[model samples]
Target: MRIYKVGGAVRDRLLGKPVTDIDWVVVGATTEEMLAKGFRPVGADFPVFLHPNSGEEYALARTERKSGRGYGGFTFHASPEVTLEEDLIRRDLTINAMAEDDQQNLTDPYHGQRDLEARLLRHVSPAFAEDPLRVLRVARFAARYAALGFTVAPETLELMRQLSESGELEALTPERSWKEISRALMENQPQVFIEVLRACGALKVLMPEVDALFGVPQPPAHHPEIDTGVHTLSVLQQAALHKQPLTVRWACLLHDLGKGLTPEQEWPQHIAHEFKGLKLIKAVNERFKAPRDCQELAMLVGEYHTHGHRALELKPSTLLELLQSFDVYRRPQRFEEFIAACEMDARGREGLEQRSYPQADYLRGAATAARTIAVQPLLEKGFKGPELGEAIKRERLKALKAYKENA
Candidate 1:
């Protein structure tokens, strides 16, 4: 049996990028031989074995045939007879189809190295359309390599458009789709992922709520970008630029979903978009099965991000209510994430990208001020039981009022 380091490891190495994971494809290897070598089988539908010592995966060189729909609807043939060329051609992108042998020999059967040099994400063959997951995968690669000037080949994008139109995207499980989306959000340029999906029509199928935001108008004075969709993408870019966490990025992307539902008569003014956005956020959160933290932050940002923007102007009672709503005392980290998402929203506008968002520090100080209100003073005054809870609330409100005035 001959093994070659394949896929991303080879692709990244060729691009002068850091390789984090390495995969091996074994040629002229049978399942029995792998089992005899003490390699444990892990693949359910194909011959994939973990090395006896290193625990690294080594999948048998195999070719796939389209037999069904979605990511799992495929038949695999792996045997001693399957050629490395046959296996490589079944890959999603040309850059990912190259392999490296043990002797350091390079195999570029499908001209993957050529596409890599050209800075293009080209599909290896027409078979790419057979798998709907390739659309997200290609978009993610675009997100990863966008800094290096990599873009999806027009022909490959056409195939993605075909997959989007084929209803195959609907066949993908929510868990699988969310995995791709969440990973893309953390990439170097997450907004490119959204743009690519939208360009290829996949965004409409996968995330209609986000898709609807693109053409909708917004007040140019508040959002210099003017388009709600563009603003949403800008927010995502800001989140990535600041190296924000997944929860903050997810919240930034979703904070403006309500603006897409604004009536044409309303044009640029969404007086209560925050309230309207909560329903869409709930549907999106439920649909993707986003983590509890992500869902809660997205909803909170959607419903109260305007309050975040107007922190300096809000009354002390409103500020205290906002802090209480976030449960900042119990879950301070989530509150910090909320603040980051709001700052992204504020700075996402055109020409205001570098604008300062002092509201974050102001709100943080308010939380600290409220938390510092000593319970000892209230207890010393004989405040106890349910009355103590009310007394603490009174103290926090008074402290917040003082903090607001002092600021």
Candidate 2:
């Protein structure tokens, strides 16, 4: 059994980036051979084993055939006849299709190394069409590597467009779509991801709510671009530029999702879009099976768009009351996430009169300060038992009053 490093570990190593996980390809090895060597068989559909000692995965060199639809419709072949070269040829992208032997010998029959050098993302073969997931993968790679100046190969993008047009994207599960989206949200430039998906026609299939933003008009007074899509993208750009966390970045992306549906009869008609967006986001969260924390964060973004800044100036009692509006203790990070998202949202518009809301800066600063102060048990104040609870309540009221008076 010959073992070689494959996938992200090798790609990261070649790029001089820190390697996180290592995958191995086992050449000339059978499941029986692996089991004989004390490797535990774990994969249900593919011949994957874990080393008994190291616990690292060692997948037998295999090839795949399209069996049904979407990403999951694949049949893998791992017989003795399947060569490592043939296995690599079936991979999604040229850069990821290369592997290295245990002795550091390169096995790049697909010219992945040259493509890597050229900072290009190219498909290994026409067989790429067999997997619809490759389009999302390419969009993700665009988000991750575009900052390094990599460009997707033209033919590969054409193939992605064709896949979208063929409706293969419809077969993708929302869970799978969100997985790629979450990764993109975690990237340095999530806007690139949205743009890439839009270019490939995958965005409309995956998230039609966002697609509706494309041509929806915004007020000229607030948004110079006059399109909800551009405004949403601008917010995403700010989130990326600030390097916000995943949930905050997602909040920025979805913050204006309801604006497209808001009436355009009056300028800035999206004033109440945040309220509408909350229900829509909840439905989306449920459909995508988002975690409770993410769902709560999205809802908070929708509910408090106008009041988040005002919340900072509330008295301690009022602040505590506001905090109780949601499970702040269980999800302490959501407030800051909301602030970051709202900041991005407020800053996204292109043409606001010079001084529409000077309170924004004050509100942001106050929110940050409030968070820092709230971490301490000011209510306890050297009291114990029932007195402790009373002191805590009194201090909360005092803090809220202080905040409001100061603002």
Candidate 3:
């Protein structure tokens, strides 16, 4: 059995990046042979083993054939005849196709080394068209490499366009699509994915609702770009620049999707946009097979347009009431995530300097006071069970009304 380092480990090493996961390609190694050598077989669909000592993945050299369409419809071949070069050739991008031997000798038959030197994400072969998932993969890679200033090769971009136009991307499973988009969202510059998706027409299939936001008009005073789509993209870029969390970044991308469908009559008059946006955000999350908590966080961000210190004016009772109403304990950290998401959305909007809002310090103080008051043991004061619940409800409502009247 011959072991060679493969994939991201080699790529990252070449780029002077920290390598975390090490993948190995084993040449001429059968499953029985691997098991005899104390390697544990792990993969079911194909031959893959875990190294006995290092515990790193060691997948047998394999070749693939397109059985139908999209990502999962594939047949794999792993035998003595399958060369390492053949396996690398089937990969989506050159940057990921290079491999290294135990002696640190690089094997790049596809000129991946040259592409790396040129700072380009080039496809390994024309066979990239066989897998529609490559389109999303390349887009995500572009997002990851954007800070490194790498551009996708023209031919690769053209292939992506062809796959998008042919509706091949539609054949991808929702789970696979979500995986790539989620990874892209995790990147520091997800606008690269947005830009690439727009260019290739893939955005239409993955998120038509978001695509509808494109060119949808917004008021001039608030959004100088004149379109909610452009404004949303700008906000997303801002969130990325701030290196926010995945949920916050996703919220920024989707915070204004509902504005496209809202009836626009005048300036600062998109009434119920937040409520409408909440519904649309939930729908999008469901469509993408997101977890229930993720959907809730998205809804929270969409519903609460104001964030950070502004949330402090909401009154402790009102904030607690909202939290308890949503069963926030079911997803312990969701409320904090929602708050972060809302803050990112608020900060992303353009022309924030001209808006009349409370000072950041005031907002922070209000929020802190609200949290303290809400968390206090009001029920412990000679109250029990149903009575305690009723008392808390009445007190919460009273607090909300008082806050509203004072404001």
Give TM per candidate: 0.98, 0.84, 0.86
Better of 2 and 3 by lDDT: 2
Candidate 3 Cα misplacement greater than 4 A, ranges: 263-269, 306-333, 350-364, 371-387, 393-407
Name the better of 1 and 2 by lDDT: 1
In model 3, where is the ten-residue run with the lowest total lDDT? 363-372
Worst 10 residues of 1 by lDDT: 215-224
Overall lDDT per candidate, in order of appearance: 0.93, 0.78, 0.75
Clashing pairs in 1: 213-229
Clashes per model (N, Cα, C within 3 A): 1, 8, 1
TM-score of 3: 0.86
lDDT of 1 at 63: 91
Question: At residue 125, what lDDT does model 1 achieve?
Answer: 95
Report the lDDT tens digits of candidate 3 across residue range 1-407.
67789889999999999999988898877878889999998998899988899888899999998898778888999986688998888888888998999899999888887888899999988889989988888998899988888988998899999898987887888798888888888887788888888888888878887887887776676566677776777777777776777777777788777776766454335666777777678778988887665565677767765534355556656555555644544544665565555555555566662344343334333333333345247655767878877876666556545555654
Q: Which residue pairs collide, candidate 2? A: 315-400, 315-401, 316-396, 316-399, 316-400, 317-396, 317-397, 379-392
Model 1 misplaced regions, further than 4 Å: none
Better of 2 and 3 by TM-score: 3
